[model samples]
Target: MTKTAKLYRMVMDKHVCPYGIKSKWLLEREGYEVEDHHLTTREQTDAFKGEHGVETTPQTFIDGRRIGGYTALRAHFGRREADEGGTSYTPVIAVFAVGAALAIALSLFAFGAPFTVRTAEWFVAFSMAMLAMLKLQDVEQFSTMFVGYDQLGRRWVPYAYAYPFLEATAAVLMAGRLLPWLSIPIALVIGTIGAVSVFYAVYIQKREIKCACVGGSGNVPLGFVSLTENLAMIGMGIWMLLRPTL
Candidate 1:
């Protein structure tokens, strides 16, 4: 005999709960025969909640035992649960991966070669530009979060707000191969500040803070990833300065 499950979900005129849909899908996918019950009316939902002593909809039951909600169902099946405010490197990794690929593609198309020193320069510039775009999404939020660890940002609140624009400006100048005198200094200063901030926060202070590298909304930890990003910018600035002499 096949296993069976019961799902009690909300299906109101204004809103059909998304978790309810997910629960039903998960049950069916797991080869369980699901008997779905929709509490369409507000009164019905209220009564069901009161009787079950549960506050939320999308309740599941297996073999006459309550299986809780969507998260619970996932846990029952031994699936990894989504982290609640936990640190992850996924956002940074995705940004760098996409940025590198774009830089390589653009260099190959424009210069007819992807292995030149220009390719490395383009990669750093593109990555900085991309990162600046993320920070610019919500400058206020990013600056607020950034002040926690960045010494310069903490001392001068305005610097946090201006950092993204500065980074973007440097990136654009470098990418366009224009105004090297201004771009090199801007990249070097900001990158140096960022590197020191990351190192102090992660190593010296041993504080566990969220990185503002990606954005205010990211959950990336303040660690090696943040340091590496700053180091790459610093290296790019030095390379640009010395390229003319070499």
Candidate 2:
């Protein structure tokens, strides 16, 4: 006997239900032959909901048992639901991915070169500026998280607020290869402080904490990524200062 499932989802002119599509795809992936049904009109959807005594679209049934919505289907299949406040690297990964793409695009469009040392430079600067932008959105919240681990942020309240601005300014100037005298020192000082703080807190003390690198609203973990950000910043600073010699 073949396993079978039935799915009903909304497919409207303005919007198609994403969860509905996901449910159908998931059923198919799990080797279920799905009888896909689309509630094209609001009235039809309402009638179905009223008849089933349910409140949402994208209902699924397996072996004549009502399996609820997409989340419910995931539960039925024993997949872990994403915790809203759980630690994740998604935000940082997204920022880095976008920064790298932007760097490559800038290199190709402006300089007509695909791969250059400048591309690497732009990627670091762009990630720095983007991360700074995230922190600047909520300085109060960011400072709360930052002071938890950063030695300087704990000693000076103002440094927590000023850190984002400093990072952004240095990044913009460094990307332009302008005002190296000012940018290099700012980057080096902050980067050195950040790297040491992260190392001590996460590696030495074995303390688990949230990172302020992508701002306070995110749940990005304070570990390798936070260290990587600081090391990249420091590397960029040193490279910019000594590039003429190499």
Candidate 3:
């Protein structure tokens, strides 16, 4: 027996309800033959909402039972939304994902190959630059979080504020292959300090804190993953230094 569902969704001249499309897709995916109803005008949509006593639309009916909006439909299908707040790596993941894509695109344009040795270099450079941009978004807020765990950041508050700019400068220089002498040292120094700070604070001292690497939000938990970010910079610096010899 084929199950059937009815969906009431907003379809307007200038705008279409995104959730309505999603609701229809979900119903079909669940093996329900959906009778999709389009409320083509604002007045029609409003009247439908009023009749159903719903604040929003893409309302679904499964066997005469109201299944609510897209979120509600998702719940009915046992789906969970991505964890967003408190402590999560979503922001870091998002930044790096975009960074990696940009790295590939840049590499493809310059080297005509997505997997060139320069691609790896670009990945690190771009990721670092993007991360620095996040910190630069709110220097004051980032410095406040950074002070709690960073050794140099604790000693001099101003250093914490200057750190993001330094990071970004190094990253940009590395990306452009500009002034290896200056950029390499900056990368090495900042990376070494960051790695040592993370090691002592999280591993030795066993302090639980947010990673300032992401941004002002302080949602990403300070841990080995954060340590890897610093390690990557140090590794990149060393690799670049050795590249001229080999």
Candidate 4:
């Protein structure tokens, strides 16, 4: 049985356009049947507004699915198909990278002079970068990937807290240089989470939802770049793990 290409209607007027022609260009590339219903009259604009609140041209409909606004439309198509899965190397590589990043991060605090604000600040910056990257890469999926917990609901409550709590801990340890051994477990936990996120983002593209790792409005969509970054962190962590002593 041949599956029909889903019909997507986009009504765009010149005045209240979103992304201008850029939105249309992207929609066309995504195989949408785009028709620019340019509304020149107040009556036309009003009628269009009545049908869909906010008379914005470039309003997208995917087989009757009203994906309003340019941002929403981008999100809809940018989402990967649920059935797709990640590459074989994604998880293994990511784990190694995260592990290594943690190890190096921990060492920074330990090796640096104690009670120095400079060292503390450096560790803070490094930790911030790592957390930003993880959030960008959608680290929230780690719980489901490694622990088999429900991505939704309190059954997977621990993963919810792990993202920030552990990140802060990693940074703290790196700054205080306290119990470098503690870093090993923390690294392991972060690596496990990162590995899972890479796996799902690559393979189960659509099923994986965005991780608002950073609290902000305009989130970057999760993709392979994120996976590779997480993988690098894993490698850094592994290097640290093998070091003779913390």
User: By TM-score, who's the top model here?
Assistant: 1
Report how far off residue 56 is in candidate 4 (Å).
Answer: 20
Q: Give the local distance difference test score of model 1.
A: 0.90
TM-score of each: 0.84, 0.75, 0.77, 0.37
Q: Would you give me the overall lDDT of model 3?
A: 0.90
In candidate 4, which residue ranges exceed 4 Å CA deviation?
Answer: 1-155, 175-177, 205-209, 216-218, 244-246
Winner by lDDT between candidate 4 and candidate 3: 3
Best model per lDDT: 2
| lDDT of candidates 1 onward, in order | 0.90, 0.93, 0.90, 0.50
Off by over 4 Å in 1: 107-119, 178-182, 201-208, 244-246
lDDT of 2 by residue, 131-218 (tens): 9999999999999999999989999989998999999999999889889999999999999999999999999999988999999899
Candidate 1: residue 14 lDDT (0-100): 99
Name the runs in model 2 displaced over 4 angstroms.
Answer: 1-58, 77-80, 83-86, 110-113, 244-246
Worst 10 residues of 1 by lDDT: 237-246
Instruction: Say which prediction, candidate 2 or candidate 4, comes out ahead on lDDT.
Output: 2
Pitting candidate 2 against candidate 4, the one with the higher TM-score is: 2
How many clashes would you count in candidate 1?
0
lDDT of 1 at 139: 96
Q: After superposition, how far is residue 120 of candidate 1 from its true place, in Å?
A: 3.2
lDDT of 3 by residue, 1-246 (tens): 999999999888899999999889998999999898999999998898888888898899998999899999999999886665668887789888988999899889987999888888889999999999999999999999999999998998888999999999999999877888988999999999999999999999999988999888758889876798899889988988998432
Tell me the spans in candidate 3 whose CA falls farther than 4 Å from its real position: 40-46, 90-120, 133-144, 242-246
